[model samples]
Target: MKKLLFLLLFFPSLIYAQNKTGGINWISWDEVEAKMEKEPRKVMVDVYTDWCGPCKMMNNTTFSDPQVVQYINENYYAIKFNAEGSGEVTFRGTTYKNETYDANKAGRNGTHDLTRAIAPVNGRIAYPTIVYMDEDFGILSPVQGFYKPEQIMPILTFFAENVYKDKTWEEYTKAP
Candidate 1:
């Protein structure tokens, strides 16, 4: 009777824990550089503004998806960067900072220099951009928008496995 009661009480929680994604192991930009020296891995930067709704949605949904979390944790160094943050980040001998940040503002604050450096789309900053970089910190791509787990798996695999080298995206997607 006690065993049955214990199982009933704890089993649901155990199942929930197992089903839930453990979430990405995010590192700082500085940590990525440091880690690269010892062991190189692809880097995926999630550039988001705090005020952006889609950014929040992506964080809660797509980023927390089990498959997405597992693939990213296994293949890349994940970074979560606030685009409007005022912190200084030094990368590849260059210092990036948000000099024009205004705390009093709502919706849009000043942009971080690192955000500009990574996700520059014709001198504009977009929320929820995913920046992919090579092991050496070279830019591979900057994908903007909120992507579901199903939507993002292909992108993750393409970069993670270096499938972009020989196969075109069209070709890769068509493959059985």
Candidate 2:
């Protein structure tokens, strides 16, 4: 009975402890451009809003997974960007702002100009948007939805392995 009680109490913490999970290296957006300039690794930006439930879930579940974290941290310069933030960013000689940021409205969020400039089709501009880019910061894909760790594993690995160089997702997935 005592062992069972202890296990139940600590299990949650064990799941969340940030230790050697998959290659996820959480970082701020400001660091991404500089890091890319310095080393030029692939980049994966997690564009999220504070009130989005799925965004929170990814942080506590998918991102917390050891395999996901390890792979992301190893191959991509992972960044977390708050879509509705007033954080200053310089992009192509222009500045962007939320200007009218509202803290409410069914959890809908705003974004800076930089977000608009970098987002892919659908303009991302959505909660929990995952933007994948190549080493040169060229946009690859924008996944604007919730996904489990397993669901994202292949997508992440596909980009990391340079599979995009020769085959499409459909072709690669079908090729053994």
Candidate 3:
């Protein structure tokens, strides 16, 4: 009983701390917009819904790793975006809103206009979508589902190194 009580108290705090570890640099949409107007860097958006299991997994696993955080912080401006929130977002001269969402309900929320405009052409719109973009806000890739730190390292590195500039992922991965 004593052990159970101790775990109940300490475990949650540990989990919370672990969840906040990774990602080198984090900024708000407003900051990203303002910076882009002056100097542009690539952006990474973790587009997730509050109730998504995989999204939570990302918070618990990938983001918690210090190495992962360090890499991201150095390379990109990371943004955590809720797909169903009452926030006004402006990207590339267009404004997006959560006009159709009623967050009070279960499993039903209006997607932002920005999400609609930038939906992946492959049509794999799932929970825990991580969108990568160039400095110009051009969509680079949309990775869906849960990915651990190991799984995401290459993708993260790919964007960081600007391999997308001269070659595709297939071409880049094929060499060496």
Clash statistics: count for each candidate: 0, 11, 5
Ranking of all predicted structures according to TM-score, beginning with the best and ending with the worst: 1, 3, 2
The better-scoring model by lDDT among 1 and 2 is 1
- Cα lDDT of model 3 by residue, 38-105, tens digit: 87888899888888888988877798787788788777889988887778888777788988877577
Backbone clashes, candidate 2: 11
Give candidate 2's error at residue 131 in angstroms. 0.7
Q: Which structure among the candidates has the greatest lDDT?
A: 1
What stretches of model 1 exceed 4 Å from their correct place? 1-21
What would the TM-scores of all predictions be? 0.86, 0.80, 0.81
TM-score comparison, 1 vs 3, better candidate: 1
Superposed model 3: Cα runs more than 4 Å off: 1-24, 37-39
Of candidate 3, the 10-residue stretch with the lowest lDDT total is 17-26
Q: For model 1, how does the per-residue alpha-carbon lDDT over 133-166 read when each residue is reduced to its tens digit?
A: 9998999889888898899999999998999888
